[model samples]
Target: MRGDTSNYRDLFLGDVPMMDARAPIEFRKGAFPHTVNLPLMTDSERQKVGTCYTQQGEAAAIALGHRLVSGQVKAERLAAWADFARAHPDGYLYCFRGGLRSQIVQTWLREEAGIAYPRVIGGYKALRGFLLDTLDRALAECGFVVLGGMTGTGKTDVLAQLAHGLDLEGHAHHRGSSFGKRVTGQPAQIDFENGLAVDILKKRHAGHAHFVVEDEGQAIGACSVPVGLHQGMQRYPLVWLEDSFENRVRRILRDYVVNLGAEFVAEHGHEQGQLLFAQRLRQSLDKIQKRLGGLRHQQLAAIMDAALAEQARGGGVEGHRAWIEALLTSYYDPMYRHQRESKAGRIVFSGDEAAVLEYLRRASTMARRPDPGTSA
Candidate 1:
């Protein structure tokens, strides 16, 4: 018999042992949860086969693949499969598709080792389908609370402090911004959503507390947010953060400079990026230039220039606080005022970071409280 194929859906839904038969590079790009690599072909082997397929056609590549897998190599692979099967007796395995690679491994496990582990019907493709479907369903069912504020209001930092659930924090590894990409590579979009799905499922299973997340505008670096989730965030209830311009700039410098490191900025042509950032900053400042005037903008420019100089000199935190304070007061504050006036929402509560955390805590508490009308 075919063992029990009926449990495959359940296996996929929950965590189940799986294997990626692709090269390490392909696997690193994205992979299913609980997946181990048991590649039939090594990285160079796959590349060679691919080159043959392109140059010599399918027949030649297939013949070469067969030749490569025969003899001692095949015996060692069978031994490894036997070990893996013994370790994860109930596990399923897959390749890019339900193809020859999976068949060879499945046969070794079942026929030789007498261990039955069904292959995924469509392999990684099926897992991709499931991930997309789950994310779409989540978008429709879940409530979202968008955390919005000007740069350096510590929106991401505050999200961490709050007890509420977050989807993007762990996957992106940094707050979403032009500089969001860290020294480490980000998770692939599929892996990001995989992590996101876990967060969403946990929140839903706990009950319908609104999921708190930062107001990211679609794509974050190389990874794109799922369209459904992105759409939901736009219409969701929003909590706008308010902070002193001085304080906000201070926070931005502290967070970005200290955490990101001065060398990072220098290595990436920090001065040039800062100059461009200043131009954008100047445009935002242009709206209020009538009130603050060109001289104020120039003063702000001078402060930013000085801060960059201090950073280049590897100066500590001394001059940074005062410079950031001036930029926020003279620049970032007025822009926020215009934004606040235009926003539409029942301002549930507002204050600095502490107040935001307090509100979220209260909201979470209310969500968990038993309703008087519904009996347990």
Candidate 2:
């Protein structure tokens, strides 16, 4: 079954949810969208089984697993899985390699739970492989337009306006910045790649010649963009997003301060939440201290603290503009400029947000038109 794993790739194309039969630790590391964790074994149980297999042998491991999972513990797990299967009739189950773990899940689901749960042929490993291969194919078949801009230029907005735009930051959920951490943390690396690959596959399957994506560094938060896609981005035509510094600052205020503050308050109480938001921003800025140099870092840190203090006293969060503006000018702008220098001669055009959106929409329509070979 593992050898015939091609069918696993198309699972995401429909509304089929996934039931991850791997342990919670494994699922937490990375997972597909619409996946619910229905672990076959607890982490300790898996560890015990692994240790038994290593020290005793496969038969001993099997016996030990049977012993460990019997009675109440076994019944509870089976009940949970049956409940999930009943709800998601079309869902597939998967483990690490579509090996014994997944097979056992399928058998037990049928025999014990009276439910026939179809397991992925090669499990998560095969599905992930398919997505990775799909990404490579997509890059080869499709042309690309790279969106370039400094932080706060609202590049994400441009991507939204464009028909074929791909928001890498949105996929990663980190905004591709030190301070880009969301109230909800970023997805695991494996999940991030799968998400991106699905998008690419959809685009490629639609026969689009190319798509637009942001120019991001390899890493976003804890997740890294797949190497091949990143390379394609480097080689693609670039469109620079230009916005005024003041407008950018206001955008930042709206996002990082106003929007984020409300979310934090909703989660935590008002006072603690504001402090955490302020601290998070400060921590993000502190990460670039070496690049900022000692003096500039100190100056900015002071401004940042004052802004936070003012907010603590119920002053407007717009005071953060002082810190944000300074950080942009001193750190982000120069860093972008250096990177741009490296990207010299690569930029195909530069325009404000509206112009770029208009360009991207037209480009998307052109890209979607029938190819000469396929033309009637």
Best model number under lDDT: 2
Where is the poorest 10-residue window by lDDT in model 2? 367-376
Provide the lowest-lDDT 10-residue window in model 1: 367-376
Local lDDT at 54 for model 2: 100
Per TM-score, the best of the predicted structures is 2
Q: Which residue pairs of candidate 1 clash?
A: none
Off by over 4 Å in 2: 1-6, 369-376
Query: lDDT tens digits, residues 227-305, model 1?
Result: 8878877777778787776677677776655655543446556775544444433354354567667787677657656
- Residue-level lDDT tens digits of model 2 in 14-125: 6468788998999988888788998888999999999999999999999998898889988998898899988988778889988887788788988988787787887888
- As a TM-score, model 1 comes out at 0.70
Clash-forming residue pairs, model 2:
none
